[model samples]
Target: MSVEVVIPNATPGTGEGPHWDDSTRSLVFVDITQKNVFRWDSVTGSLQKVHLEDEVGCVVPCKKGGFLVAVGRTIFHLEWSSQKLTKLHEIPLKGVGNRFNDGKCDPAGRFWIGTMGKVLSFEPLTFDMEKGELYCLDVDGSFHKRLDKMTICNGLAWSSDHKTMYFIESIPGQIMAFDYDVTSGNICNRRTVVNFGEFDPTDPENLGIPDGMTIDTNDNIWVAFYGTGQVICFNPQTGKMLRKIEIPCKRTTSCCFGGENLDELYVTTAQAGSTEEEREAFPASGSVFRVTGLGVKGHPANVFNGNF
Candidate 1:
């Protein structure tokens, strides 16, 4: 089977952390290197951009209103109306080369954001892989450290049943699952669900590590490969590869679901470190993709319950 994807907006650098806003019927994403946030309306086919002072890794809608955005080491409640970012709380992982990365709100409305160390560089690919940490912003405005020593904290998703939570530490090249407590917003008993070691990086069939992911109605996991130019699906419960959807870009980064029926799978990619030859090969890199008719629907994104 073949799935056709549409590029709604083109970006300049690394485009990561895609989110679907059910309320506005649009898709939101960030260009980390460009330090810009974008919102693309599904119906109007229009794109809106917002600039920040520093790198913006992720942006998720808040329950009360506006967006909860992770900018460097601090998280803010960004209001589009006034173009303002109201300070919520800042993570203390600063000064150690740590910055916020991919994040999302859990089923219980708690915000779970992860961080990565600036010491790492993908161009030459060198750094301490164990310097980052993942934190949970409680509904009561308190920060709780959950996991530590992460290199690049990426993809985050909760099972439809809310019993399992999936997290990715990008550098390790593996996806981990944990026993999720939806009511308490806790993740424990971590175990590897998907390991990239099984896939050879030199082979085009298995290009690069998984960067970001999304879940379907049937609980299958669809992950975007960083340098692979494809979004592959797997049965997370069984660790079996299900399907691979080739993309027009080389550095596929993240994905989510949007549209009225929530059947459209939106994918994001990166083009920042590409050489001229590489750019000529995959000109569509760093573009937001929209793929439909995958025969699976994804859950609507959860909103942050924390105050702005």
Candidate 2:
């Protein structure tokens, strides 16, 4: 596999939640701390950025038109061409400290998103644990609470058959699997698919916490490790590591499959709380990266079926 820096220093803060828009042939992602949503056109090699008033967590295309965006604790419908944002629904949190994080649309077109506790500090990497929750937004604009008491909820993906859902809880360093009902958009039978145990976010020698993830046509899970400069592939069924791709930046936040044939992997990194030494060591810290020649393809991202 070959890794290339597509956009050098794409964001000044954390870059998370990447989705490939097959209809537009572009890569959509968000810079959380910077409160910016970006779209990079693959064919034209041009970038379009939309700055929002709140911290943007994720962005997904809509089947009917426009786009669905998670900003702060609310979901909004964004008319990209006009740069208009209309609020859809806001999730009620126990405290104001919680906010939306990584999210994506399921095969059935329901938005699955999770929240994280108050960020205490980035330099020392501290946060309030077990204060977050996961919610599912349906096509009818109704919200359903899935799980609660989560710590640093992040990456989410479903199996090729849409029967198994994979979720990442970063602080506990676990990849959870749940039996899913595609039609009803319900998930149950929760179990641990991959457990890295609890990790210390402050320790540079740690194995790294799982952040954002995506699955390939063969059902292999590609997970981006936060503290480690690596994106590891795993066989979810066997819970075994298959391959590993080294990234230039240590704080690799998220990744997705893009390209015309969906054979390329796009990764996003962060430079928000990096020290001077780290910035010098990894010059492409906040850049967007593209990995090609992996010999595997992924399914096109699902768009929200709701007609706002």
Candidate 3:
């Protein structure tokens, strides 16, 4: 019943992927458009941003120190101290106008990532339902393309038991579930888990867009609705929405649980849809936020250490 938006004022245009760092008890996220990575400590209310020359789409802490960054069309291992970027792999399809989008590490320590067609140009949407493949880079340095033909591969989460996987495709607004085999880190039996209704172009509130998501300790799924200004919670098994957290910003991009005890929910918002006047009115449009409640703590993702 009680909700408050922390960090309501922050820099705008932040398309971020959040990572929970247990070592420092801080929540890390990036402003992809701004080319900056931030570490927020809930205990001291400290926020630190590291400037980078290139756009860093996602950041996952590396087990050996530094971070594995998913930049525009390639994945790299970054050494934060020296500002060095080492290219790891180039996603296979460059001609299709598809580029890496959302990514996360599976429980098996393999990184799962998806690509989307560039929306700026007239190029047909690169989603090949057969080509928009999900990929995994094992600790052994071998790469595997898991699934494909996905348009804007977004939300990715694994159940606590590591037997189920949840994924989302942004355009059509569908959340899918897969039966995951832990032994081989393979997924199958893909099925629709949830679907949002269409929005009336005349009414703003009814439009629900799919974005990033995080799973709670109790298996509840919290998804950020890109254009809806809200985060909806759902029971994964029943596909029922249990609650919604209202956000003031129109483009709520992503969320994750991070804190000393992992009880606080940190959210990232964007100024992607702001008009010139609206942009000036809300300068910190692309800032991070925090909220409490929902009784959930996220499982920190494991970084690849080059060991199979």
Encode model 1's per-residue lDDT on 1-308: one tens digit a residue: 44454653367788998899998888889999899988888789788889998888899988888898889888988898687988877777554567888998998899999988884555655555577888999888888999987788889988999999998877868989999999888788999998886445567656487889889889988898887788888899999999888888878999998889998888898888878898888777777878877888999888898654
Candidate 2 lDDT tens digits, 55-168: 988998999888888888898999998999988888776554789998999998988889988788876777888988899989888888899999888999989999999999
Top candidate (lDDT): 2
Give the TM-scores of the predictions, in the order they appear. 0.94, 0.97, 0.88
lDDT tens readout by residue for model 3, 223-260: 98876568888998998889888876767788877777
Whole-model Cα lDDT per candidate? 0.84, 0.90, 0.74
Model 2 CA RMSD to the hidden true structure, in angstroms: 1.3
Point out the higher-scoring one by lDDT: 2 or 3. Answer: 2
- Candidate 3 weakest ten by summed lDDT: 121-130
| Candidate ordering by TM-score (highest first) | 2, 1, 3
| Descending-lDDT candidate ranking | 2, 1, 3
**lDDT agreement of model 3 with the native:** 0.74
Q: How well does candidate 2 match the true structure in TM-score terms?
A: 0.97
